[model samples]
Target: MRNRILILLATIAIYSCQDKQKTEQDNIIKTIAEDTLSKTVAGTADVSDASPTEDKAVELIRKQLNVLLKKDLPAMTKEDRFFYYEAFDLNNDKKNEYFVGFSNSYFCGSGGCSGYILNNDGTLINSFTVTDFPILVTTSSTEKFYDLIFETGGKFHLIKMKNGKYPSNPSVQEIWKGETPKDNAKVLDIDGKKLEKYSF
Candidate 1:
């Protein structure tokens, strides 16, 4: 009788130990699974939070601008520099002309940011200082080129091609006394979506 009782107690102890060991293993696995799930959720959020992917044309333009402004942009970091651009056919030649705005301390001033109008082949048509973005193209044409307009210092300024080139300075340009064009489209608003990061 005594031997049987001892055997029964030993069996119970063994079973209890096995059960505890299995529970611990299960808990470890559950903990690992939970941690992995949390990390995956965080990773997904990171991807969604980033800016929208840019198109191929914009990417190619960035590379071109990098080459065009190589000397002035080599020292600037990716965060401190930006460029805003818009394309339109100013010459009525069916080829689009690009308007590239420089958003950095080196190029900007109290008047406004500096910008450029480039031909379809990335050649500089004109460079401007102290001007606003989204350079409005008027419905009226001058010398077969679209008249450009922008606002600065609470006044609108008109830019017409003179001697085959637009005005290089906006701060001193004559302010437009006429009404703003109703058919113009605002090209580059200064929001996060339109500003492209400057890269070397």
Candidate 2:
């Protein structure tokens, strides 16, 4: 009778450990599923052609934007919280760079609105004080970063990387006299109605 009781106790211990392991496995799978879903939802862009790397870049950029907006404009209304972003490989590197545009009045002016260029890791590469949509990515590059062309005051300006950064203000950049390149990719050209609201 004593030996039987000991065997029963051992069996109960084994079952308890198995149940605990199953619970842990389920929790891990649940966490992974939720994380993937959140990233997918957060990274959904208006343009459906985004690649996997681009989607990851968008998710990182969104997190950075959320932090900035929360810190700078804590009182931002729903309209003020809208932003547009596009991820493109500026160089031949596999990593993609991000272009984010803001329509909030605080970030805009009579000339144009503010735009930002961010590295794949969500570091600020550059910021434009007065810039407009349809930003052109030229076939040519400088400092390993592609040159950008954008219009302001009815003239197209070519922005090049100088001193390890693009010009902070596009209004003062040199005007592009050459014809627009057929292969240039347009960034942040989407309609404002499609802008994604801040996740924060």
Candidate 3:
């Protein structure tokens, strides 16, 4: 009888362990699936093709920007080149506006970068050179802000200005500065504004 009781207890223990292991595995898989789904959704929502009126303008602007980068910053490798062209409702306006960003590499890499805002009619509104690696680019009423939260060699920086201010002087003081780690940087928001160092 004692032998049978011992055998039953062992079986129960084994089953309990197996159940716990399965639960853990399920949790891990669930987390991974959630993350992947989030990324896919975010990417899809952010991508926008140029409209009929802006299609030609986007191509022209892209061509011009590519030429400028190739001529001026020849050190950028082909793989490092990236262009983010999208249309969104900037400034809470009913009409969608163009948002463009040219980068040499990821936010932490070396390269020259520029951001542009275009009117809904495809006219140039404003453009500026962002001296830092911009991880995220966004716009608002009266100003467009580029968030350089994860850029390397410096902290976060925010570039902001009104439309038609292309080639405007960059105010370093207005940029958000923060102390970021060399490998892993933590992004912090202060008083609704990103705090980080700004370079011209």
* Per-residue accuracy of model 2 over 1-200 as CA lDDT, tens digit each: 99999999999999999999999999999998888788788975353576786567667877888766666666676667667887789987998788888866977778989878888899988888778787999888999988999888777899999988999888898999978786778888766336443432
**Which whole-number lDDT from 0 to 100 does residue 107 have in model 1?**
72
lDDT of each: 0.73, 0.80, 0.50
- Report clashes for each candidate as comma-separated counts: 0, 0, 7
TM-score of each: 0.64, 0.67, 0.38
What value of lDDT does candidate 2 attain over all alpha carbons?
Answer: 0.80
Pairs with backbone N, CA or C atoms under 3 Å apart (clashes), candidate 1: none
User: Model 3: per-residue lDDT, tens digit, 35-148?
Assistant: 878877886332345366555655655665565455544665545555555555554567766655544343222434556556666566666553443334332223443322
Give the true-structure RMSD of model 3.
Answer: 14.6
Off by over 4 Å in 3: 1-82, 104-111, 133-153, 162-171, 177-200
lDDT tens string, model 1, 131-165?
76656778877788888787776678888888888
State model 3's lDDT.
Answer: 0.50
Clashes of 2: 0
* Span of 10 residues, lowest total lDDT, candidate 2: 191-200
Best by TM-score: 2
